[model samples]
Target: MDCQVIFQPSGRRGTVKKGSSLLEAARKLGVDIESPCGGTNCCGKCKVKIDEGYVDELSAETHISHVSQLTENEKNMLQPQEIRENYRLACCTQIEGDILVFVPEESRSTQQVVLETGKDRVLRVNPAVRNYFVEMIPASLEDHRDDSERLKAALLDRYSHLDKELSIDYTVLLSLPVIVRKGKWSVTATLWKEQVVVALEPGLVEATYGVAVDVGTTTVAAYLCDLTTGKVLQQDSMMNPQIRYGEDVLSRITYGMDDDNGLAILHQTIIEGINTLVTRLSKAAGINVEQVAEMVLVFNTAMHHIALNINPCYVGRSPFAPAVRKSLDIKARDLGIRIAAGGNIHCLPVEAGFVGPDNVAVLIAEEPHKQEKRRLLIDIGTNGEIDFGNKQRLLSTSCATGPALEGAQIKFGMRAAPGAIEKVRLDPVSLEPQYKVIGEADWFQPSQTIKAKGICGSGIIDIIAEMFKSGIIDPTGKFNMQQTSRRIRRDANNKPEYVLAWSEETSIGSDITVTQGDVREIQLAKAALYTGAKILMKKWGTDQVDSVTLAGAFGSYINKESALVIGLFPDCNLDNVVAVGNAAGDGAKIALLDKDKRVEAQEVADFVQFVETAVEPDFQPQFVQAMYFPHGKDTFPHVQHILDTIPTVKRSKLEAL
Candidate 1:
C-alpha cells in the first residue's frame, strides 16, 4: 500500500511505502537527521514528531530515550508518556500508515560529511566568486580611446546604475589589453565582489579554481576546488614531504635549529609537494597549472612554521609558545607557494604550539562544547591532544600518546591503508577466527579476499580485547604464552604473536600477527587516552559527562567495546560515545565556505586553555596504572558489563583468568 509522508511548519510533503522506517524514508529523500550512533536507535539526535499520523508506539524495550527537550507541540506529535511525550527518535520509529512528520532543525543533518575519493564532488557550483560577460559598444569615429580607457569608460558608463567602482590588480592588468583586443573589444573578467579584478580572459567563463591542503606531519591531503562554484574538483593525498628530516615536530625543529638552510629545505619540500598535487589535480580536472587562483592551507604550528620557513626553536621550549597563533592571509609568492599569477594562500588559525590549527579546525567543525553537558573531543595522532568542555567553558591539553595508535612503533603495525587488517571476530563454533580488512571486502566471505598485511588502529583495539579475553594478557599487561592457544604462536625473536591470518592465506610472506611489542605500544596509547580523560574529569569537578565525541580519521571506525577492553577511555556509559568523522576536515570545509567561521575558529583557538601533559604531577602514575588491561569490574562497571556478555572462551589455554 502507498503511504503519504507530510512534513510540518509549512506542511511540505512526500511519500513512502507502507511499513517503512521513518528514518530510512527520510534518508532516501535526502533529509538530514543526526544519528551519531549510526542509526542504532540511540544518540537521540534524530528526534522527530509525528504531526498527524497513524503509527504504533515504540515498545518499552527500545534502547532510545523517549523523552526530549522539544516544545509542547513537538512533544504532542510524538508517542507521549505521562511527564513527556510526542518526541520519537527517527531511527526508532516506523511509518505503518499515512503520516505528517516535523523534523527539527537540530535533528536535521547540516553540512554532512560527504564521502570523498579521487572523483567524489563535495560542493555545489554556485561559487562565492564568479565570472561575468560585459559587452561594450566600441568607440565610433565620434569617440576614440585605448583599451584600458575604453574598459573604464564602459564600466563607468554602462554599470553606472550601481556603485560601479573597479580595482584591477597590477598582475592581471599585464594581460588585460591583449585579452580585450583578442575578444574584439569585449571581455570576461573574473571580478571578486564586482570590484577587484582577479582575472581577465578573451571570453566569458563559468568558474575559477583553488586548492585546499591539509599539511600534517605524516600526511598531506590536497583538494582541488572550483572557486567560482565551490565544488571539489579533485583530491589527492601523499606522505608529507618533510618526513625526510624527521617524524615529529621536535625532531624537525631540531633539524631547523641545527642547520641554517633547514627551514628553506622544509619550506621547499612542502611547497613542491603541494605544487605537485595542484598540478596533478588540475590536470585531472582538465585545467591549466597557471589558472589556479588560490591555495588554502591548514596545519599544525610546526608544519605551518616550516611551510613558511619561520623559526620554530622557541615553540619547543618552556611555556610552549607559538610565533603567531592567528590566521594569516598572504601572497602565494611571498611564502613561495609557486602558484599562478594571482593566487593567494590562507592558513587557518592556530591554538597553541602543541594544540595547533588542526585542533582549531576540529573544534570549528564539530562544536562539541556547545552542549551544556560535558563532551570531550579527542584527536589522537603523533602527539595525543584533547579538548574538553561544555557550553560555558572549554579546556584543551596535549598528551604524548606517541604514534602507537597510528600503527607506529609496534612490531606488526601499519596504517589504515589497503590490505591493513581492520577488525577481528572469533568463530563461535570452532573458536577460530574471522577478520575484516579496510578495502573492498570482508574476510569471512569466500568470494571476497584480502591478504592481511598488518594490523591498523581498529584491529589493534580488537586484538587487545581478544588478548584480555584469552587470559594471555594479565591485568598488569604481562603476556603469558602458556595460557594462550596453540594458534597463538611465539617467535624465536622472543615476541608473542597472536596469529590473525595464516601464512598461506595472507598477503604478507608469513602469518599476520600482533606481536608483544605491538601490545605494549597499544597499552601506552591507551594509557595516554585514559589518563587524559581522568585529568579532564578532575578539572571539570565531575565524572558524569553528557557525551564523548571522538574526532579524526581513525575515530569513526573504532569499536567502543574493544576500546574499553583496551582501557583506552574512562568507564563511561557506552551510550555516551559519539563518533564525529573527520572533524578537522569538516572544519576545513566550513572555513572554506564561511568567512565568519574563520573568526569563530580564531575565538575557539584563543579561548582553549592548554594543559601541558608533560608537567602534570599525576600524569606518570595514571599512565602506569592505565597501561594494565582493566581488571576491577566494579571500578569500570560500564566496561565490565559489556565484557560480561561476550561468548565464553572454549579452549583451556585461551580462557580468561
Candidate 2:
C-alpha cells in the first residue's frame, strides 16, 4: 500500500510505501530535513510533528494510528515534552497511511545565504568555445561538396585565420545539412578550441553562453556568462542535494561504499541540480538551454570524485589518492548535463588528497603564485583547504573540520539563515550579550520580540571569543562557575551552558544556548583548521605570513576580529586579513571566459605541493595548544590589546581537577 505524505511549511507532497520513514518521504518530495546522521536515527535532528487531525476524509482516530509508535531510541533521544506534542523522529517513524507532517524550522534545512559574488578581475575574452558566422555558396551538380567540407571552407574563407583541419561532432554533423539549408547555406558554427564544431545553428547566432559552477559540499552555485562579451548574465544557487546523503565528505564517501547505488544517486542528484541551474539561468537570461555552450566545474577531491561517479572511498582513506589528478574535458551530454548538443564540460585539475580543483580555482583567482609577499589562503568549510607560500613556492593541505563551524553537530546550531544569530558581543564586565540575527538590521533587544532560532558559524565564533574575553569561559573553553550572571546555567544533563536567548525571545520555545559540548565541537573544528595552517606554515619554514586571504562562502562571512580572536590561523596583521568571497567560483568563471586560465589552473594544481597533516608528528601538540582561545603559545600582536583585557586563568588551576 502507498501512503500519501505531505510536508508542511514547504507544502511539498508525495506518496511513499506504507512502511517508508518520514525522512525517506521527505527526501522523495524534495523537502530538506537535516539528516546529518544519514537517516540512521542517531542524530535525532530530523524531528517532524504529526498534525493531530484527520487526513482528507479519514477520521482523526484512524489517521493517528498511521504513524509507527516511537521506539526506545526515540524515547531516549527526544524530550518528554516533545513526545507529548506529537513530535517524532522522522527517521524513526514509519508511515502506515496518509499524514501531514510539519517540520520545525530547526529541523528543516533552511535556504542558506550562499556566497556567489567574488572580486572580479579583468581578463581577455578568449573562450575555448567560439562561434563563427559563415556564408557558403549553394551546392549544385558542379560544386557538390559535402556539408561538412563546404562549412569548413566557408569558415576559412570568411575568417582567413582558420584551422585547415576542422572536425564536426557526429551529432552536429547529422543536423548540419538541415541547419545550413534552413538558413540558405548561412549558418553559425560553434567550435571548441577553434578546431571542432560542437553546434550548428540556423542564421547568425552571435550569442555564446557558458556556465561556471562551484560545487561545494553544502551548496552549489552557477554563473551564466556571455562568452562573446565575457560578462556574467545571470547567477543562481541551491543547496547541494547530496547534502541529504551526508553532511560532510567522509560520510558521503561512506554512503557510496556502503550502498550499492549510492554513487549513482549522488552523481545523478548533482547533475540534475546543475541542469536545474541551467534551466533557471537560461530562462532568466531569455535564452534556450541549448545555447549554453560550455561548463567549468570545481570542487574538493571527494566532491570531484562523487560528481564524476567515481568511488570516493579511496579518497577518504589513508594516503588519500584521487583517481585522477589531471584536468578532464568530458562531453556535457556524457555527464548528463543539459547544454548545447555537443558542448564540453571542463573539470579543473585537482591536487592530492582532499585538495581538489576548487583550491586550484582559488589560487588562480587570487593569483597568489604571482605575488612577492608570502600568502596564506584558507577556504573554510566542512573541509578546510589551506594554502601557503607565494611566488617562490606554494604548499597546500586539507583539514577535516567537520560540520560544526557550519552550524552542524552543535546543539541549537543552524546554517546562516533568517533568525540565525550571526553576531554576538558580551560586555567585558557585565557579561551581558547582545546579538544580531541574519534578517534583522539591529542588535536583538529584550523589549522586542525577536524570534532568534539558533547560532550560526559566525555567531558561534563570536560568542566563543566573547565568552573567553569576558571571563564567562576560560582559555580552556570551560565555563566559569564563579560567574553570577543568570545566563550561565546548567543544562538538563548538568553540563554548563550560556544562554544566548531566553525562551521568551526564541521561536523554538526554548532557550538557545552555547552548551559545553557546543564549545568542544567548535574547539575541535577550529583546532583542525588552525593546525592545518600551522602545518603548512611549518613546512614552508615561515613563522609568519604577509597576508591571509579567506575564501569560500563561510570564510567570507566570518568576522576577521572574531576569527583572529579564535585563532583560526596564524596571526597576521589584522589589516592584512581579507575575505575574497567565493574565490573558487570566481576561478571557475575565469576558466569559462578564458581558455588560458584553464591551462593556468592545471599548472597551478601541478605546481603546488600537498602536505599530509595527518601524518605530521607535531600535529597533536599543535592541535591541543590551538584548542585554547587564540592559541596557547602563538601570539597575536595585532589583537594583543584585546587579549590583555582578558582575565587569564592559571594552567595549574585548570589542571588541578
Candidate 3:
C-alpha cells in the first residue's frame, strides 16, 4: 500500500511506502526536517508530531537518560496532543497509518534565527587519565621482608605506595602478573580512576595530552583533551588574533585587501596565538608539544580561509563565494599551526557563501532542524548568520552586523573575559546600573575588585537600557539634555559620553566611557541584526515564529529586557528566546566526541541556503532606517507601543545592549 504525506509550511505533498518512517515520508514529500544522523536514531533529533492520525503510541520504551538534559519521564511520554505541542523524536517514530502531523517551528530547523541552549557538557572532565598497575614477585625466605619493604628493595628504592596501605581492584590484580611480566617486572600505568585504567605501558608512562580549538573571529577557545582516550583535559580561551586589523569580517576583508601579505599575516597571527596558547597549556599540563597529538580548528569561512592561506577576497564580493566549502583534514604545519608535524588538524566544513564552518559544526551538533517543524539556527556575532531548513529544503544567510555586538568598534568594547562587565541591571526607579563579571563562580560581587577594563557585550546592553530609562536617549537614538547625571559627560572628541567607569575605578588611567561614536557603532550593528532578521522572515514567508535561539557569549550575557528594548532582535516570544553559550565550541566538542559527526557537518553545509545581505537591495535601506535606538514600528510592529513611550531626541541615541 502507498501513503500520501502532506507538509504544511512547504505545502509540498508526496507519496511514500506504507510503512516508511514519518521522517522518510517528510523527506520524500520535499518537506524539511533537520537530521544530522541521516535518519539514524543516534542523534535523537528527527522529532515530529502527528496532529490527526489513527496510530498507536510507540511500544518500545526509549529511555532519555543517555540523552543530554532530558529525564526519563519526559522521554517516556510518546503521544503528542498538538503538532506544535507534541514531543516526537522523528528519527525514532514511524508512520504506521494515514495521519496529519504538525512539525514544531523550532524542530523544523530553519536557518533564519537560531538560539542554542547553554546547558552544554563541554566543561565536564573525561575519565581517560593514565594508570599504572605493578606487582612485585612475592618476597621469599631468602629475600625475607614485608611486602612493602621487599617491593621497595627490589624496585631500587623507588617511591612505592604499598607502605601507605594502598587498595587495588581485583581486576587490576587479575592481570597484574601478566602486565608486569610483559614489561619484565616493571609497568607504566595510565589511570583515569579506580573504575577504569585507560592505558598501560611496559614501563613508566605519562598521560599529558592534546587540545581542541575553535578559533573564532571575535574570540578563541582551546580545549586540552587526552589523545589516548579522547578526553578533554583543560580548556582556555582568548580573543582572535586579527582583531587589531578590524572588528568584523568586512573590516578584516578590507584589511586583507589593503595589504598584499594580509592573508598570510592574519594566518600567522592566528598560528602564533594558538602556539602561544599551546605553550601555556603544555606548561600547565607539565607536558611537551609532542604530547598533543591531535588538534581541531573550527571557525568561520573567512577564518578557515585565512588559516589555510586561501584568498578571501572572493568572499567579500558578489555571490558571496568562498574558497572551499568542503571539510579538510591536513597537517597543522600546512596551516602554519605550531605543533608536531604528525599532528592532525580538522577544519569544519561550510554550508553556503555566508554560512561558514561555524554553522556546519552547529547544525551537526544540535541537529535542530531534524524535525518536521521549521527550525532557525542563528549565530549572533560579528556576522549574524542564520540557517533554515526542515528535512528537505535548507536556507542560509549572513548579516554583516560588524563587531558592536561582540563589544568591538564601541568606545569600550571587549570580548567576554575577565575584568569585563557581563551583567547589568538598571533600577526602574533609580536608573542606577548594577553590573557583574564572569569568574570561576557566579556571585553578586567578584572575588577581587579589578578595575573595569572595558565594556563587553553584556555591558553594552546595560548601557543602552539605562540610557533609555534616564531619558538620556530618545527613541531615535538621540541624546536628551533634559535629564542629567554624573554618568553623562562630553569627551575630548567633542562627542557625548556615557561614563561607565570613573577615572580611578577602571584599569585604564582615564575614564572608560561609551561615546556617541560608540552609539553609532551599536546602531549599525543593531541595524544589521534587524535587517537580517527581517529579510529572513520576509523570505521564509512568516513573521510569527515558535522559537528563536540566541547563541554565543553576547546572547548569554545580555538581558532579555535590554535586548528587546534595544531592538537587537525582532519582537517574539521571550520564553522562546534561549541563551546557548559557546555554541560553536560545543559543536566542535560534539565532533570531537563523535567521529561520524564530521561527515554530518558536511551534510549540514550542503543543505543550508545563504541570502546575501550586502547584495540585496532592500538590505541597505533597512539598515539605514534601523540606525535609530529603537527601530521604526512599520518594520517591527511588535514593539510599537514601547517605541511610542520614548520621546524623539537625537544626541544620545542608539543604545545597544
Clashes of each: 7, 0, 54
Candidate 2 lDDT, 67-172, residue by residue in tens: 9988999997788888888889998999998888989988988888888899868867999999999889889999978888899888888887767788888879
User: How far in Å is the alpha carbon of 279 misplaced in model 1?
Assistant: 2.2
In model 2, how large is the Cα lDDT of residue 617?
99
Question: lDDT of each prediction vs. the true structure?
Answer: 0.66, 0.88, 0.62
Error of 3 at 225 (Å): 3.0
Please give the range of 10 consecutive residues that has the lowest summed lDDT in model 2. Answer: 55-64
Task: Give the TM-score ranking, best first.
Answer: 2, 1, 3
TM-score of 3: 0.63
- lDDT tens readout by residue for model 1, 371-459: 68788778766776788887687888777676567665554556676667788876433437778876746564545565666667777
Superior candidate under lDDT, 2 versus 3: 2
The candidate, 1 or 3, that scores higher on TM-score is 1
Which has the better lDDT: candidate 1, or candidate 3?
1
Best by TM-score: 2
- Per-candidate TM-scores read 0.72, 0.95, 0.63
